[model samples]
Each structure stands twice: as structure tokens, then as C-alpha cells.
Target: MATLTPCFLRIFAVLQLAACSFPEEPGPLISAPAEVVRRYPVFVGRAHRSYTRQEPLYIQTVLKVNRTLYIGARDDLYRVELDHVSGDEMFYSKKRTWESNKNDIRICRMKGKHEECRNYIKVLLSHDGGLFVCGTNAFNPLCANYTRDTLELVGEPISGMARCPYDPKHANVALFAEGSLFTGTVTDFLAIDAVIYRSLGESPALRTIKHDSKWFREPYFVSAVEWGPHIYFFFREMAMEFNYLEKVMVSRVARVCKGDLGGSQRVLERQWTSFLKARLNCSIPGDSHFYFNLLQSTSPIIRMQGRDVILGVFSTPSNSIPGSAVCAFDMQQLARVFEGRFKEQKSPESIWTPVPDEQVPKPRPGGCAVQGSRFSSSNSLPDEVLNFIKTHPLMDEAVPLLGHRPWIVKTMVRYQLNTMVVDTEAGPHRNRTVVFLGSTRGTVLKFLITPSPENPYSNTNTFLEELEGYNPERCGDDSVQARQPLSLTLDKPSHTLLLAFHSCVVRVPVARCQLHSRCMKNCIASRDPYCGWTKGSTCSLLRPGTRLPFVQDVEYGNTSHLGDCDGEFVNLFGM
Candidate 1:
């Protein structure tokens, strides 16, 4: 399980004790709100009249639940509720906070030629106790299920073509699993085929192969997570194994096998017998690396250091200065590069090899078989393993990056980091790690990791603050929600941080240290692992396993704990 040649020299090189390194140009020490003194107060997700009446509500999907908040917007659908915890906004609380009366049977937009009907609610899943919603209804993609405390509509209306994405600004990913829903989007209306599908399953509907440009070359999906019997997803295509006259793109991470059931109506019929796809290396390491290659946003499969990790949000379009990065990947290095080797590419004029472990084929083509197990599913494999997975679905190593670089890395800072979340509070000793990026001009940084004192298995970022979330001169003329981008939502049971902006959704504070540090050296220079400094009581929030006398260095801020605040908390700092 641990052998890939020093994990590829622990993934590329540049040692001080190598295994990962990068910071050739890192910036952001602290920013805005007068150097992060943070008073903490934002909370706006509903002014309703659709973002304060008469057109301007662009929030395309949010889903908090528990102090509720559903919100999906464009042709509307909402349900906000937050009756307490100071960050108020209980617009009709006991009345259940509703707005979704949607029954939507538009049946693919009933023959309208003036095609601009506008629905765009774009998939917002919740699972189990109901609330699955999906929409682009004007372009005719349906899907329903609501009522998490009366948002209504609970049965009938399902056929959201490749599971939503008829172009409400295409970017998809759905997920439900075992109760089947799994999507990756783009089934057509001239959106150009691209799919990963799987639709309402338990047996019939599997996708990915129709119009296959060698398995999706125009992708853009970004974000999907299930891990285990596999689900993965995360995208940014167009590098069918590189051919460049300038096209390249590549930032993938595919997988599929929530018990795949395809092949056997002539090799991959309803397709995707365990999809495949690799390449997500995110460069910056070494004798010329640099890469970043466009993967805009991913993070939901967290739990670092103890493993699992996800965190992406790369960028690379440089025509003269444009770059971004945050990288993290490592689900056992993507299951050891999807269990190693399988890239072939034989005829578009030969040359991208790797298929020979004596012509490799057995119980592996992205496995997940355990029903009676004996090659238990892709409809009973072995036609030479479905013809070696229809000419190999690409994968010959290239998953790298656990610490080959990128915890954060901008470049001349021209904005465009669209969305990421990763949180784990309560630590002066254990659970602490945080990172919340999101920028496309409205800003909201907040890093604070620490482990690499030169590879303690790598990691070391600390930007700490740049929180000016969504401004454009304070929405004058509603500034079209500032070109609609910036979508984070980590409501970890109310440690709060909703932040949307395309129709507005703001609730901050995943730590301004109990709403503005009352001292202990400004709560240890705001290294904020959710704040500390307690010994005589002041800068708060240290909860999990607190034996009292707090102080916090969280991973390595170590300001010598300010020599224990020298005497009666030096007046415990003030008011």
C-alpha cells in the first residue's frame, strides 16, 4: 500500500527537507476591516422582493438546514430561517419560512421559440429527510422533492435530463448515491454532450459515451464527492492526453462505480462501467513546473492530516498574468492513481502508452464489486474486460499533490478563486485547521494552516484575513450581484459562514475570535484557530477538551504565548 518510489520522491522536489514546497510568491498577511480587527456582523440572505424587490436576486443554490436556509434563485425558490444566535433574519419563522410553491411540470419548456424563459435553480441536494430540487426549467430540465418543513412539492416531476444543466451557466455535479441521482451534466440542447450521468438508478440509466470525445473533452463540472465505493468527479477538461496548438486545460479527477452496471449490450452500452480519468497534479514544483491548469473549485471530502483531503480551486489562464492555486488532493493519493496504469490512446495517430502489465485486465477497471464478488458487475465483465475498458479510459498515474505544493498561491493577485471551504475548529491542541477562500473580486480569504516547518508531511499557509465579501460599491443598482460568482456555504451546525452573492447570502464569522479579540496579543495575532487566550478570561472560543487556562498557538503561531500576559491579564485588555 505504500510504494510508488518514495511516493514519487514524496511527489516532485525542492528540498529543505523536501516532499513539498511552494511560496515563490505568496501574499496576504492581513487585509481589510482595518487590518482584521473584525467586529463580525454580516448576515444577509433575504431581503426578499427577491433581494429587495423588482429584479436582482441571483443566488443559484444554497442549502444550510438546521436554523434553515434553502434559497435557489433566478425564477425563485427560497426558505430562510435563523431565529437566534444574534445573526438574525427570521422572516416569518414560526410560519416556517417558505417560498417554494413550485410544482413545475413545464415538461421541457413546451414548444416556445422565444427561448429565454429563465428557471435556473441548479441542483441543491439534501437527502434522507427530503429536499432534492433541480432546475433550469426554462430550458426544460425538471426534478423535484421538497418539504424540509414545508417548502412543499414532494412527488412527481423528475426527468432533469442529465440531471440538471440546460444552461443556467453550466457547471454541474449532483450526488445522492444508493438512492441514485449522480450527475455530472450537459446532455444537450446544443450544450455539446459531456456527461457522467447515472440518473435515478438501481438499474437502468448510466451515461458517458454518447458523443464521447475520448471521454469528455469539454468538461467543466468541478465538485462531487462520495469516496469509498467511489464517486469523485471534479473537472476541467480538454486535454485528451495533450496535443496542444494551445488547448490543454486538464485538471481532472474522475471515478464512478457506485456499483457500476453498464457494458454487455456491446461494450459499454448505457456506458460508464466504472468511468476513470486522472491528472490533477497542480504544479509549481521544480525545474520548471508552474501548471495550475484550471480546475475552479472543489472541497467537500475534508478531514486532513488524518487523511481523506480534497480542497482544490486552481487557475491558469495566463496570457500575461493570471494564476491561482490552493491544492490538496489525497484520498490515498486517489486510490493509488486509481490502482495504477491504464492509459492507451492508440489511433488519432498513436503515442500515449502504458497498457502492459501483460496486457492488464482482471477484476480492475475501477473496481467496487462485492455482491457475490467474482467480477460481480459491469454486467459480468470479461470480454477481455469489456475490451480493456473500451480502449482504456485514461489513467496512468498523475494524481500527485498532497504536499508537492500549493496550500495557497496567487500571482500578482488579479482575483478569480471562486469558492472553497474546509473547516475544523476547536483547537489549542487538536482539531484546528481552517481555510475559506472565495474571490472573483468580492473577496473573503482567511487561511491558517500550519505543519510544514519544512515538511512535517507538508502544509503551511497563514493568510488570516481578507474579508470584504461582496461589495461592488455596496450593490448600487444591485451591481448584478457583482457578476455572480463567489459561492461558499459551510454552515457547520452554525459556526456560520453561508456567503453566496448572486442574489445575496451573507453570514460570516467562522472565527473573529468571539467577535473581536479582547486581547492576549490580539488573540495571538489572530492566528484564529477559532480564537483563544483565557487564563484570566478574555479572547474566547476554545471549547473541545479545554482544561482551562487557554492561550492557543493552534498549529504554529507560537508568539511565545505572550509570556502569559504578564500580570492580571494586563487589565484583560479593555471593556
Candidate 2:
């Protein structure tokens, strides 16, 4: 490990670097064909209350346990269960008070902020066969526990001021693992003290990183996940290494070793001994230098094989650009970048450069040392390594996106992709992977991902269906009403998608490809594992114990393996 000192020199060097500017040449907008856009049925669940004025409700988070979907909303918590075909609310708990203090509201207004200050249940985590919920209790935060069986609050409330944010729209990340809570949010009223803290049992809370521009500048956190003994946080932050006078946002993946118990008090104590961040590259290959700079959401999909892949939705840096894209990164790729040479600025003004391979610190200060029996805690690590990690938290090299290009890209559209989820299932011919994307304009999209025959390791996707997320009546006769989606969640057991909007939650069954495919060519073209073409010249959805002699291999698009389906019959539509 290399001890990083002379911080003043680095800061001075940063001030000297000249800004680089490039002319903006956005890509041309493209639209999908009409035939490929198929609509699915949706079930809208709205509040049943009757009031003089309909209050707005945002379903910010959702969780599923067996047959029920637990929805966390502004000032309320609702349990929705499958009522045979549609979702039915089992009960609604008024978990939070919607009223905000007049002083708080006035203060926020005086600061030129328009958002209301109220207690919204922002955190609804499933822990130990129960629920651990946190809410913005009228600027003051509170945490409580509830029983899933009885739907009753079981424990007394605890202070959640630092654990959750008061503003509903503010970006925060939280993940619960091994009976511990890991959270990243603002810990103050002014939204200045942004911190990441780990709370384990009754032990003293451990916090790392602060509001300092040297650490992070205007970070918008997207996702957090735990793999092995480390928890990773993903976000877009103002590029500290960039010499741009204007803000240049870069995607970042930061990791923290879970076993780290902070540094020694005087020297470098109570801070993460292993906190490292690296840039995430999701750019197109070739001379065009096309790149997806803004990261919106991330879905970590575990593969049937040993490795896992992260699927992320990104948009162009400029909000005016009408485009969005999806990219995937293998876990191995991320690990390699973290293990690579560190990036350093020789002088504060010098361009950030990667350290030579041979010059990198031995034993890699960012590497996890607590994984083995030799060192179970940070105390066992050499003092040199601990000191090196304290200052050198940012890695030089960036983690490149898998395939060197986005798997899916859409352009010429007013709406941007907001959230996504990936599900892998058994297909008629082979294993099939599907992605559900939620758009900002209240649309849910389904796409089937198949392994490219030309490149077996890579994947190609086909658009399957598009579903309307908002109800017609509630949307009114505006003729152009589109509610932005707040969250997207999957109900694995029920084979359904729970789409959360500001006004309502819509539960839509995963496209019923099995029941709807009618013709041989239709089933194959649909590229849905749920539906397959059989020998009788008819398309059939797959069912348990169902057997077929001929089923289309949608991935390779090869029919040679399967016999013909009757005679050549093309059913014409219209005219």
C-alpha cells in the first residue's frame, strides 16, 4: 500500500489544469416500428378515500413477500394481494403523518425550494420475518418495526434523522444485510452533511465520507448492493478529476469493506479502512465517441452461472438529448478495475493519470484483507496499508461496460428510461432473459434478451410489449397526461410487475405470451419463452408437464432443429 500525503499539492494542481471543451453533436432520434409495440393489460390501485381535493401520493418503494406486495407511499403503507386475477388491498396503515411544520415549509420556501416537507415512509425493509420501516417524520426522522403476520407495529420508534432524508424527492440509498443497516443520505436540515454510515447491533455507528468537495461534490446516488464481504454504492458525482469549469458528472462505483471497524481514533479512526471508488464507462465504441453519461438506475441480476451482471439504464449528459440506453457489466469486469493500478495526479494541476502497473502499491490497499482467517478485522492490517487507504480512496482506472456498447438504445422519444429489472427463466428452446423497463412517461416495456449466435457470450434483445401504466379516468382528458414512474419492482412468485407512480400503483401480469400467441410465425417472432410453436401449426404457451416436438429457438432464430409446422400459411391482416 502507498501512503498518500502532500494533499495540498494535489489540490493546487487541480486548480491549474485547463478545461477541455468539445462541440456537442447529439445523435439522430430513431423510433420503433408500430408492429413491435404491443400493449398489455394493467390494474391500477388508488386510494379509496373521498376528500374535497384528491391528495397526491407517491409510491416510492415496494416489497413482495409471497402473495402480497408491500407498497410504501407518502404518509401511508398499503398491503396488496392477488385477488384471483387483479390486486386487492388487504389493508392500509397510516404509518406517517402528511403534515409538515409551517416553519419548515416557510424555511424551505425561503430557500427557493418548492417541494413540501412532510413525513413520508421512505424506508420499508424486510428483516427477520418482519418489517423495518423508516419515515421522514415532519423533518424529524423515525424508525419502527412491524410484524408481517399481524400487520401491526411491534417496536417503539427510534431516531432515524441520519438514516433517512426528510425530502421525498431527495436521492438516498439503503441496504440491509447480516442484521446490519447501511445507509447513504444527508444528515442535516440544510442537506449539506451527506454521509454513508454502517450500523451494526449496539456497536458505535461507523461513518465514512462527508460533504467535503474533496471527497464528493453533488453526488446523486442510484443503487447499493452487497456481494461477498463488501457493500458497493453507485452514483453520479461531479468529476473531481475533470478540469472542466462547468460541472462534469461521471458515474462512480464505491466499495466499503463490511468488516472494517474504522481507523485508530487520533491517526485515522472511525472511518472506512477500505473505501475505494472508480469511474464506470458505458460508452459506444468507434470514432464517434458516443457515451451514456447519466446513470438513472441499476438492477443486479445474478446469473445461473457463478457470476453476476449489473444492468443499468443511462441517458445522455445533456437533458435536451432525446435518448436513453441500457448497459450491462459483469462482476468480473468491476473486480478487475478495482484491482487495477490507482489513478493519481502527479501535480495538482497535472491531468489525472493512472499509476504504472509496477509502481502500484504492493498488496493493493483497496483489496479486502478481512476475507481470510489471518486478518478478521482492520486492526490486523498493517498500519501502512490503513494509512494508504485513508487518503487514496479514488481509483485511477475506470470500470468499462460489458460488450463495449449498450445492449439497448432508444432515441427520438420524449420520455426517458427511469427504472429496470431483469428476470431469467427457462425458455422453450433454451434459457431466456427478459428485462422490464419503466419510462418517465408512464410506460412499461418488456424485451426478450437472447444470446447472440455469432457471439455466444454476448446478447441481443427484441422488443416484446409496451403497457400503459396510468389509468384513463384518473389521467383525465388532458390528451397528454403522463405521470413519471417512481419505482419498478418484480413479484417473482406471482409472475407480475408492480409499477409505482405518483398517483397510483399498477400491477400488471408479465406479458401472457403463452396464452396469446396464435400462429407459428407469431410465436417465434414474439421471442417470448412463455409462448412456443407446436407441430399443429398453432402457437402454444408453455405449461408445467407440457411437451412439444417442435419449438422455435428464438435466440439463434434457427428452425432447422425443429420440424416444419404444417404448410406455409401467411395470414394477412387489414384490407
Candidate 3:
């Protein structure tokens, strides 16, 4: 690598300073004129909560089981019935389940003083006909189980180090699979040790190497899920494969086997045998590599063909560029990279190189013992495989995005996209994928994913709706209330979306786009698939009683049927 000159270094520093200048617009800059654009009003329903002097009102997590919607706040849990609300209902009510005890409020000081020692429920997973709950108990986390019917605590507190975050704002993930809990988080109170641990119901826990350089490096955990026989953890961290002088961040997927157990010897005593990470590339197709380095959020969607694809929301860091992008990674594409060569750095100043197959340890490091072996337990496996996994966990090649391009790209903006949820609905001709993207401005935007007419391999997304999760006027003096989206979950049974903000949770009905449009021209111009012009001179959902004459996809902004439109639309122009 070449050394940077003083002149070039000065210019680079100036460019970094300009990246912090925030834009005035809260979201992607829309070029549509205000006159022709129709802003639809969102119908929002609130969940009730009993506020106390010490308890915070903000909702941290949202989960739906059966027909009841379960919401977790800092100190209380509530369940709201979905059947009471009619099919076309817009609002509903709530009922409380349980509140936190004084012991849950116990606190311990770590980085800052006056950090409130309160139980903020961060992890909520469903298991065995009940809910598994965890909270940040003032840096000392705790976990418990509750019955789904009564919504009451059923057992004593359990360890929650990897299940919950010490701070409410820290990134963490928890998943349940095969009657076990898998989590990735910082275990220590000072937030130092970032570990991936698997806890069986009554068996000893299995974790990654503690504070190991090759394992993790201050990772910001995004999402975790269970594939065929492997559990994958997605996160972003400083690139350890690069030279020290080049400080770049990369998104990665680390995989561990469901049957993995700790090694027997001193090399990796309670550590993972099937642990490896590879880069996730989300970039444009060009010579000048423009990378979206931040993996802010992710969602796993199972397509109609029974194939799974992970949708990730990525953005350039504040020091690089001001932009956000969405990319989808197919499981078939990711599986090939994991089977490729491994990335290794010989020296501190040297670049990463792929290790030859001959140099790789026998039993093919990171492979499960069941593969070409008879051992089912970690104690029975050979030590050579465990030793290789301790150091060579990073892969040589990077996993490319699904279509060689992002599905949605927004640049020169301010709002950072936080979370995403996807659902499939029946279109006029075929099934269409609808995406719900949450932002930091307490706004949830919806779009319909379709194929481009010009390029079959490429895809297009049509903006459908915009919803504000909270009331900006309620903030009064505090501006934080107007922003901050905590979580977003789609309820298919109720045909509603549950959005969690810093202060509360709101339910917004989907597929109501036609009811908000006043004119046929404006409805079609909005490019929303849910909104269509009907023969009754009004915008509405398609039904058996409706007669259709002018119906187009309207996704490509095609107005060729404008000449066929009759009614007040033609008379207003004096045609």
C-alpha cells in the first residue's frame, strides 16, 4: 500500500467534515410536485397503558400470537384482542398483563452516572405455548417465562446476558429454535465481550471465544435466524482482514451449527466449533466501489416458491456519504460463499490472502462432525478442527447482493432507515411483494416491489403509503419524541401493521389506499397499486359489485388512459 501525502490527507479530512451536515428533509427527496401529489392520511389506533411515576411509557417490542397482540414496554406488558376489531375497523383497545417489580428496577453504574436503573423489556420470544421475556435490569439482565393464556410469570428468573442489552439503545438479537435460545450481545457490564451463545432448556450453554480478535470486534448486531441446520448472525464491524492503515467497515454473516458443542481442550474450551463469518456486499455495479457499509436492519421473507431471502437495510456511514439502500440476499447465493476459501492475514502490514485447500486443517475446519465423521459430541471431535476455527473464521470471498443492484436506493438525504417488514398480496394478475420500511423520523413507508419492463433481471418498487407512528405535537418541548422508531411488525391475520415508537405503539390498517384518494388522476399518478379508479367516479378497493373500464398497473406512471377517463375529471378541464 502507498502512504498518503500530507496534501491528500488534508483534503480527505475536509470531505469527512462535510458528511455530518444533515439535510432538512426527513426522508428521501421526492421530485413530485405538491399539487399533483396526494398525501394520504393514516388511520392509527393506540394501545392503552397504565403509567406510573417510575415506569416509562415507551414501547420497546411488539409481538403477535394467535389473535392477541402482545406489546412490551419498560415496566409493563399488555395483550390486545384482535377479533374484537372488525375486518374494516380502524382502531382498537388494550388490556394489561403484568407490571415490573421493585427488584427489576435494581441498577448498576457502568459508563455514565444517573443512568436509570429500570427494567426495560428488550427481548420477547414465543416458545412452548408461552412467551420468553427478558429485560435490562440496570445492567444485570434477567429472564422469565409467561403463559400465553393468563399472561403471567410462570417460573423463576433466568440468566439473560446474551438475550438482552445492557442499554436500551444498544443493538441485540435473540431467536428461539429447536427448543433452545440463541442470542448475540455484549455480556459484560462495561460492554466489552461480544459473544454468540446458545442456551438449551436445562443443558450447559455454548458460546464463542471470549474477547477473541478473530471472533468479533465491537459488532453492532442486526438480526439472527435459523436456516437448514445452521444458525446465522448478521452484524457490522470494523474490517479485521484489511491492513491497519485502511480502516473500513463491513457487513458480515457469522454461522454456527445447531449441534455445535464446546471443544474439550485448552484451544477452545467452551467455544464454538462451527463458527465462521463472511462479508455481505451491497454495492452498485461500477468500477468505483461505492459500498453501503452499515447494516442497520434486516428481515427474513419466505417467497411463494418456498425459498428464503433476507432483506437488509444498509446505509453509508456518516463519515462517508449521506445515503441509504435496500438489498436482498438469496440463500442459494450465500451458501456458495460459505463453502469457498478462507481469508487469512499473515502479518499486521500484509493484506488478506486465501488459504490453499492443502494448508487447511483436516476434517475441513468449521464443518460439522456429522460430515464424514461419526462423532456427535464436541468432546469426541478432533482438536485440529477446533484450533483452525479459533483463528480462520473469516471467509476469502464476499457475498454479492441478489440482483447486482439494490432494490431501492436513496441518496442526499437525512433520515436513516431503521427496520423493514415484507408481505405478499394477490395482485390483479400475480402475487406482489409489498415492503414496509421504518425510519428514524417515526415514519413508516410502504412500497410495492415489481419487475422492470425494460430489464427482466432488474426490479422496481412503487411508493404506496406513508404513516407517522406518533404525534409530533405531543412532544411539546422534547424533540426526541417526534423521532425514533423502535420496532415494526406486520400482523397478517388482522391486516394491520404494528409500529413501536419511543413513547407508544400504534396500529395502522393496510390496503386502504383507495379510500384516501379524491380524484382518479391523482390516484393513478401516486403510483400506488392499492389505489385504483372505479366506475362510480371514486377510488375504492376492487369488489364484486364494482365495474371496471379503465384499469392499469399504474406502477410505471402510465397515463395513456387519461383520455378515456369520463366524469367530473373531464368536465373540470372544460373539455
RMSD after CA superposition, every candidate: 19.3, 8.8, 5.6
In model 1, how large is the Cα lDDT of residue 440? 78
Evaluation by TM-score, superior candidate among 2 and 3: 3
Give the lDDT ranking, best first.
1, 3, 2
Report the CA-based lDDT of candidate 2 relative to the real structure.
0.67
Give the C-alpha miss distance for residue 45 in model 3, angstroms: 12
Write one digit per residue (lDDT tens) for candidate 1, span 134-190: 877767777888777766778786778988987777888887888888889897777
For all candidates in order, the CA lDDT equals 0.70, 0.67, 0.70
- After TM-score superposition, the amount by which residue 450's alpha carbon in candidate 3 deviates from its true location, in angstroms, is 1.6
For candidate 2, write residues 1-575 as lDDT tens digits: 97657875664443332111122223311132322322332323343333222565556677777776677766667665544442232233223333445775566667565644556778888888888888776666777888775567786778887688867767888878676898888787677887778884543577775655655677788889998778989888888888878878888888887766776654347777678888888766653455678889999756734468888898876533456788888877887778877766667788877777665554567666645566666656667777666656778777887777677877656778978987776454336777889987777777777766776556767776676665545433213333677778777555667776666566666655544345455466556666666666566656434566556555544443333445454432211
* CA displacement after TM-score superposition, residue 24 of candidate 2 (Å): 21
Order of all candidates by TM-score, from best down to worst? 3, 2, 1
Give TM per candidate.
0.35, 0.81, 0.84
33, model 1: CA deviation in Å? 19
The regions of model 1 sitting more than 4 angstroms off are 1-71, 77-120, 123-160, 163-206, 209-253, 256-266, 269-274, 277-328, 339-433, 436-448, 452-455, 458-504, 509-518, 529-575
